[model samples]
Target: MTSTSSTFIAGLEVGHFTDPRRPTGCTVVLARQGAVAGVDVRGAAPGTRETDLLAPTNLVERVHGIVLAGGSAWGLEAATGAVRWLEEQGVGMPVGPARLPIVPAAVLFDLLVGDSAIRPDAEAGYRACQAASPATPAEGNVGAGAGAVVGKIFGIARAMKGGIGCASVTVDGVTVAALVACNALGDVIDHDTALPIAGARTLDGLRLLDSRRALLAGEAPRPLIAGTNTTIGVICTDAVVTKIQATRLAQMGHDGLARSINPVHTMSDGDTLFALGTGAAGKAPGMMTLGAMAAEATARAVVRAVRAAHGIDVAGLKLPSLAELGRA
Candidate 1:
């Protein structure tokens, strides 16, 4: 049987730990039974851990969990917590005498969104694991998306709130799903309508500014430092796949980003995607079919991210939601 909820993949659980003090936190996706995994990094500047092990030639074939976090590189500590929690649960790759949790993680730069000092840490990551569930994950201004913002082409003052979103598709009893934390450097568009949904605003802060067209028109943008933006996500499927195929799935997942996010994969962004194959359904769809489903799920998740976000007004930072802009 297939789940009606898009986020419910067969063999994965999702969790988030958002810092109450500031807009910084972490999210964890657990494959406790172990799943074949691969990763693809499209942006120029990415902060990640244990990604090399996901290479097709690497020794490890499966990962126990994947972490997506905020607080720049410091958020990588969250993965440490997830590792510890998994170890306590006796879930990990069997070492000579001990069980070592295999967790690969990625982080986005959210330091500028709130108090940089209040970033996700080992404890935050542990809490996120404790909150893991199979139900649909909470979206918008939560998890890694709490501190996320978009459309920085004009600067922070003209940016909109970015967030996390999830979607899934099932074909022939094989399920594929995606969960994304959207913190892009450009505008988010409604793929169906081809209109800007959230992103850079006019200097007057009254209307949406089409970032792609504006950039093409040679409008000078504010100086955007590297590592200031990113969009991180995970693609999961019940279909069996090899590490190489999983990597290709991650690569195709980027198509979803390109479809919904303008000016994606910029030098300042560290866009990364990870793919997990659980083999829960004991079904192996053709690679082409799986990739197409992945792309579609990813694109829908990206659009849902901005639409689900709420306006942010705290600590002297104010990023409006699509609703606030009358576009929701």
Candidate 2:
């Protein structure tokens, strides 16, 4: 038997489509049997699709898939491909003669790192769905994390490489898992050690420059640009939850971000989290317990994202990873 992460909820599959042309791509999470979904957008600038319908008051209580992508707003197109793929698989909300798939999506900015013209499109999304698997997805410098960067408070030149990561926590039979694409304006901290693992670098690009402490010391940061940075992700749980409960779970998921990502949810970053309740375990842990696990999983995933990243030099831009800096 193969061992899986405690955060890996049964019956859910993850897939990625990375563009070889550059570090820009998309990730898709499929719940073919459908699952209750909710979302919370904490960042001021967000790029998303079908988010309004996830509100507790909306008619749609479940979503078949969720898409996280890079390439800024244009990456949302990946969700369309996911919808088409689901339709072909005969998985969706039954409505009359049609089986319309509901797939909400969010994207991060990575146009400056490489070829902005070669972003993920509908075909890329379809290919991601084709590669869906139950195994834990690969982390760092793939999918939406391909072009992701962090510690942009000092601008891209001194920023560190960011990537995708997944983590899960379990209490009794209940499990909560998270997958994060780290592209923020600040540093990723180790929640347990209270130390910065990755983020902005010193002027010489040889050491860590804690963004929060720098801001507190009255240091000036780069000019803010909305939607140029973001941290987008998804949360999954095996415990039972209603749509409203899922929304609250997503809100709690931000607690993990606050713990792990310094200067998070700023005006320049569009941090969004989506939650899906598959209820595969038939366990319904108290909201407090479930939320706590969700936060823990999210923070762990955030740190893992940068730790798994690899240094990249492209388009005349060189961003180093934690490994390259000997910080991993």
lDDT of each: 0.91, 0.92
* Candidate 1 residue spans exceeding 4 A from truth: 1-7, 326-328
Report how far off residue 311 is in candidate 2 (Å). Answer: 0.5
Identify the runs in model 2 with alpha carbons over 4 angstroms from their true place. Answer: 1-7, 326-328
Clash number by candidate, in order: 0, 1
Q: Give per-residue lDDT, candidate 1, residue 127.
A: 98
User: Candidate 2, residues 116-221: lDDT per residue as tens digits?
Assistant: 8988889989999999897888899999999999999988998999999998887887888899999998999999987898999998898999999999999899
User: Model 1: C-alpha RMSD to truth?
Assistant: 1.7
RMSD of each: 1.7, 2.1
lDDT of 1 by residue, 42-120 (tens): 9998999999999999899999999999999999999999999999999999999899999999999988886788989
The alpha-carbon lDDT assigned to residue 62 of candidate 2 equals 92
TM-scores for all candidates: the values are 0.97, 0.97
